[model samples]
Target: MGEIMGNFRRAINNTSLSRFRFYFQAASFLLLIYGGYLALNLGDQLPTFACIFSEPRGGSCYLFGLQHQMTTPWTSYLSGRGIGLLVGFLTFIAFFIVFNKAWCGFACPLGTIQDWLTALRARFKIRYANYAEPTFQRLKKIKYILLALLILIPMAIGNSFFGLPKLNHDFGVPFCMICPGRTILPLFSGDFSQLALDLSSKSKMILTALGLMVTGIFLSGSFIKKRFFCLFCPMSAFHYIFANAALLRLSKDAGKCSRCGNCYRACDVGIRAIADDLQHKNIVKDDCMLCGKCVEMCPEEGCLQVKFLGLPIYQSTAEGFFKRMQGRNNAK
Candidate 1:
């Protein structure tokens, strides 16, 4: 028991954990640049699946290709607008269960933008207020309300009580109009052409607000900590609902935990996994973006790992089998 306890203590004091956090942050930035480039060049649109839009004849609008086809079918089905919404809901559920918010951390074009802005803000030594506390938690709900409005208002108007077939027609692609990801693509491509007719004054205001929000997030992350915009993203609301059952989880061994709070401080999501009760050893909180920073920062050996399907999937350090065998023999 004494030997086992000593090894556990040694693991907790390990220093490589901090280096891993640096690497994870670097990788996320590289992915953002690549995704942003794809969004800008219109390379994200595949030619084979272009018939799903109202204006299929006008070459291939970036909105027509990805966001419209993917999110709409799901949103429509969820809103009871069509049978396809069921498919969308199921697919989203599957993704949530398997990988949690991996999409937001890695693949989301908008997330990439926010991350880049945060990086820039950090480099320039800017400052913004930290909105990560309980007071700002309610602000996170705005996305869900917006999502509800996006789906509900269209369904109500499309039912024809308002005599608005044109409104219904527009509803098929409404999310694209306000999507920050789609908007940023046009800005990067050096084409203000799409901005002239498509964006309304309200949308322009929203865009302006989003720009300011990005700036604030950047400044906050630079002066405060990384991943500031994650607090208010609607996509995260969806992820929050499904995170509890996610197949991949960050696990911590309580016996090895030294209670130094370094992992909590390193975590941008504010999950204090080390301080939590032992029964729920998994930090399966909705706020966790699965960036693996906590796992990387954990000083305890075998105390922190990324687990999948009830088995350990990733470990920061590797010890030879002979060493493990020797340790086990000595323990006996």
Candidate 2:
């Protein structure tokens, strides 16, 4: 049994994790983005960007449902509507805790699109840019602010909190108003209608304008920088709140890590902590997508691992690293 297990581990480690990820992501992107055509409906409580605006989306993102539910009248809190909202939130949490933020790394259509742009840039021999550590520290806080606003704005629209007047209904789904997914994903289904600016109200006009601008930036920036939009994604902030109790986890063996900097280089979002932090056993940071790139890149045996309920599914190993390198060299 021990020898068989060892052979299985060697087989897995010898395979190209990057190639496996690319195919897995491609399959997931298809199911989420185009599965509705086949009558697939996962639910409305998914943690990732399965944009409802996309006509063929198999599932809907939780943030959109959360914003819609938040617009419920204040008096409904003691009623069945409140119970329904609670159920919805719990459902979202259930889906989220299973994979933590792997939804963002593995299933988000927007993230996949950004990665495709990065690939296109690489194909053209263009260099990708990284944010300076100081800039990254500052920018990472934006997601939380967006998450706060996403919750508060919708509640304000329904109830007069603290003598504040009810906001205009034109501000419906405020985050969705500016989310690039609303504009980008629909294009996959041959729908360019989201690009049309709403002239009906000042709030809507401004929101649509901002949405278009952000979409433009999302396309151009993602080409030059890896996972650009992920830095400011409110969903990422939401995921991190329940991350510690998640079933899937990224763990580091500080004793095994040599701080060789390879993991840092392979990271799509440029999480320096993965390479630098030495104290934390649970190394899943706020920006980490649990994409397993660090583990794939690490040269040390048992340095980094993807664990499910405390059992390691994959881990770094020297033999695996050399095998992967040899495969790449032979391909070249």
lDDT of 1 by residue, 145-193 (tens): 7555555545544354356542334454454445443434444445444
Q: After superposition, how far is residue 299 of candidate 1 from its true place, in Å?
A: 1.4
Model 2: pairs clashing at backbone N, Cα or C within 3 Å: none
Candidate 1 residue-wise lDDT at 147: 54
What would the TM-scores of all predictions be?
Answer: 0.61, 0.98
Clashes of each: 5, 0
The TM-score of candidate 1 is 0.61
lDDT of 1 at 264: 75
Off by over 4 Å in 2: none
lDDT of 2 by residue, 168-220 (tens): 88765999999999999999899999999999888899999999999999999
What lDDT score belongs to each candidate, Candidate 1 first?
Answer: 0.51, 0.91
Please identify model 1 stretches exceeding 4 Å from their true place: 1-82, 124-129, 159-176, 188-225, 273-279, 316-332
Q: Count backbone overlaps in model 2.
A: 0
**Which candidate has the top score in TM-score?**
2
